[model samples]
Target: MKPIVAIVGRPNVGKSTLFNRLLGHRRAMVDDSPGVTRDRNYADISRFDKPFILIDTGGFEPVTEDRLLQQMREQSTMAMEEADVILFMMDARSGLTPADIEVAKMLRRVKKPVFYLVNKVDGDKLEHESAEFYTLGVDRFYTISAEHNRGVLDMVDDLMDTLPDVAEPSDREELTKIAVVGRPNVGKSSLVNRLLGYERVVANPTAGTTRDSVDTLFMCNKKPYLLIDTAGIRRKGKTVEKLEKYSVVDALRSIERADVVLVVLNAEDGVTEQDERIAGYVHEAGKACVFVINKWDALDKDNATFGLYVEKVRMEFKYLAYAPILFVSAKTGQRIGKIIASVDEVMEQYTRRVSTSEVNRIFTEATESHHAPLAHGRRVKFYFATQVGTRPPSFVIFTNQPESVHFSYERYLVNRFREAFGFNGTPLHLMFRGRDKKTLARQAHNPA
Candidate 1:
C-alpha cells in the first residue's frame, strides 16, 4: 500500500487540473463545467523515486440538498478522510467565496496536513488576488496555475516532505488480488460488500456511484486476498465527461494488476456489448477470470432460467469460454461462496507449472493426433516445447519454421495442454520460436 494524497476543493477550482498536472498526464478529467468529476479517481505516482497514491476527487460541495450533489460531497469527504495529506485548492480568479471558507472549516476538523493552493495564478497580476485567502489563517500557501503547470513542482516538493512512512503487510504468502469490474449499476460494489460482509464501498441504485478502484484486504479460510472494487465502466460513446473517461481507465488499470478478475454481469439485463468489452480486457491482459452474473434474484427464475442465462453469457463472451461462470445474487448471498472457491481454484491453475518431460509428452501426443501443417511442401517441424512462465501458463515451442505454425494449430496445441493438465479459468500463451545456431548449441548441451 502507498501513501495517499488527496486533492479537495470547491467546485470549478481547478482541482482536477492540478491532479493531471501532478500526474504529468491527462488522467483526471478536466473541464470548465462544474462538478464534472462526481467521484474520486486515484493513480499511483512516483517522483524522485518516491511513490504515492494520488487521489483526484469531486469538487467539495459545502452544503447542498440535491441528491447527487450530496453524494459527491460524501465522496470528496471520504478522500480527505483517507488521505495522509490533502491539497485544498481555491480559484484565484474567483477570489474567495463563502463556500471556500466553509470548505476551510471542514478541513479544520481533519487532523491531517492540508496544503492551501490558490490555483490559476498564471501571472503576477493574479498573484495579489490570492493574498486575501490568508484570511482563512492557513500557515502555508502557494500561488500556482494548475493548467500551465506553474509552481506545481514547488508544492509537490513541500508535500513530499510531509508524506507519512507506510509499513508493508508481512504475510507468508503473497496476497491474491481479485478485481471486480463491470458496467454501471451492475452490483459490483454490492458483491464486494457481500464478500467482505460489510459495506466497504458505496453501493447505490445510481449508476457510477463507485468511481474509484478501492481495494480492501480480505481473509477467507485462512487465505488473504485483495478485493479491488472498481468503478462502473461506461462505453466510450456514453463516457462524455472527462472524469468518467478517467474512471474507465482506472478500472482497466485495476484489471491489468489483478491476478483474477471477476467479470460481473447483471442477470436482469442479460449480457450486453459493454460486458463483453470488459471481458475482452481480462482476456487481452491474460488474467484468469470468473464470470459473475449478479442480480440473479431479480430475474424471473424457472427450471431452465439458470441454464438459459448461462447460455446467454457463453454466447456473448465466446472468447472467454474457458472462464468459469457463477450465478450469484449479491443482495441475497446466493452462491457467493462459490466465487471465492472459484477464485482459489483459478489462481492455483494460473500459477501451475508443468515439468519439461510432461510438456514434451503433451506436445508429442498433440502432434501425433494432428500433425503440423505443411509449408513449402514440407511439414512444419516442431523440435521442442517448454513451459517458460506461469500466471496464465506461458509456453514456448522451438520449431524449424516459427511462421509456418498456423493459429489453428497453435489453438490445437493449447487445447491439448489444457486437456493434459486442467488449466481451468486461465488463458494459455503458446509462442512459436525458430532456433538459431547458438541457441541450438546451448539447447543440445542443456536440453529444455
Candidate 2:
C-alpha cells in the first residue's frame, strides 16, 4: 500500500493549486473563490521512484453552524484519519486567522506529523511575512508558491524522508481497478463516500466539485480494489478551461486503465446525450461495466418505472448490451452493497478462459442454428474458433471467407457465444481471419 500524504488547510490557501503543482500538472481546479474545493481529491504522486498517495482536502473549519462548512469539516477529519503526514497550508498574504489557530490545535491533539506550509510567498518580502505562522506552535515551516512551483519539491522530499520505510512495492499486481465516471454533480463522490462508510470525500450540492481523478485503495471481503473517482466528463464544446480539458483527458485515461467501470447515471434526469457519449467511450475501450443509476430514492416510481428506465438505457447504450444495471441510492445506502459483488462477478467473466474444443463446439452449433450470410454468391464458412486472450475475452474465428461475414452474422455469433457462456458485464472482442488451404493445413497440424 502507498503511504497517503494529505494536503489540508483553510479555504483559499491554495491547497488545490499545491495539489496540482505536486502532480506536475494542472489536475485540481484553482480559483480565488473560497470553498471552490469542497471534496477531498486524491491522486498518486512520486518523486525519483519514491511514490505515495496524495490527497487534497477541503478547507478545515473545526467549528461552524453552517451546513456546508460542517460537511467540509467532516471531510477534512476523514482525510486526517487516512493520511500518514499532513501538510497544513497557510496563506502568507492574509496572515493567520482564528480558523488557522483552531486547525493547529486540532492537529496538535492527534499524535501525527503535521508540516506547516506557508503558501503564496512569491518573494523575500512575502517570505518574511510568512513568519506570522510560527505562532501556530509548529517549529518547522516552508515558504513556497504552489502556482510557480517554488520549494514544493524540497517539502515533499523531506516529508518522504520522515516516513517509516514501507517494504511493499508501489504497484500491487493483485488488485482490481474500478473507475466511477459520469457527468458533473451526478453523485460520484457521494457514492464513493457511501461505499467507504465515511465522509472520505466532500460532497456538496454544487456541480463539478471534484476536478481530478482521486484514487483510494480499500478491501471488501478480503479482496483488494482500487477505486478511482474522476472528474465529470463534459462535451468538447463545454470544456472551455485548459484545466477542464486536461481533466477530461485524465478521466478518459482512468477508464482505459480500469478493469471495471461504473457508469453513473442520474435517475432524476434519466439518460442524456452526454451520458451516452461517456458510455460510448467505455464501450470503445472494451472495459467491463456496471450501469449505476444513482439518486433512486428521489424518483417517483411504480413497478413499471424500472422497466421503462432500463428500456431507455438499453436503447441508448446498445453497444454496452452485456453490461448489467443496478439501481442504487447513495444517499440512503439502497443496493450500494451490490456494487462490489457486481464488480467481482464482472471480473470473473473478464479473466475467464475457454478451451479450444469447447469454443469450436459452440461455434459449430451457432452456425448450424443461424447460417452465416453469403457474399459475392459464395457461402461463408467458419473452419474453427479459438480464444486468443482473456481480460475482455478476445476470440479469433478462422473462416474460408472472412470478408463474407456480414455485421449481422458477426453479431449473431457473438450473441450465441454470450448465451452459451455467460459473458455478463464484460465486452467480447470477436475477430475474423481468412485462411487458405496451406494455412489451414498448417493450423490443423499445429492446432494453434
Q: Which candidate's TM-score is highest? A: 1
Between which residue pairs do clashes occur in model 1?
Answer: none
Q: Write the per-residue lDDT of candidate 1 for residues 122-157, one digit (tens) a residue.
A: 999899778898999989889999899899889888
Q: List per-prediction Cα lDDT, in the order shown.
A: 0.85, 0.87
Window of ten residues with lowest summed lDDT in model 1: 41-50
Highest lDDT against the true fold, candidate: 2
Cα displacement (angstroms), candidate 2, residue 89, comes to 2.0
After the best TM-score superposition of candidate 1, give how far the Cα of residue 60 lies from its true spot, in angstroms.
1.1
Alpha-carbon lDDT of model 2: 0.87
At residue 119, give the lDDT of candidate 1.
92
lDDT (tens digit, per residue) of candidate 2 on 132-215: 888877778999898888888898788868776667756655889999999999999999999999766667787876766777
TM-scores, all models, native as reference? 0.86, 0.83
Clashing pairs in 2: none
Which segments of candidate 1 are over 4 A away from where they belong? 166-177, 193-257, 373-376, 436-441, 444-448
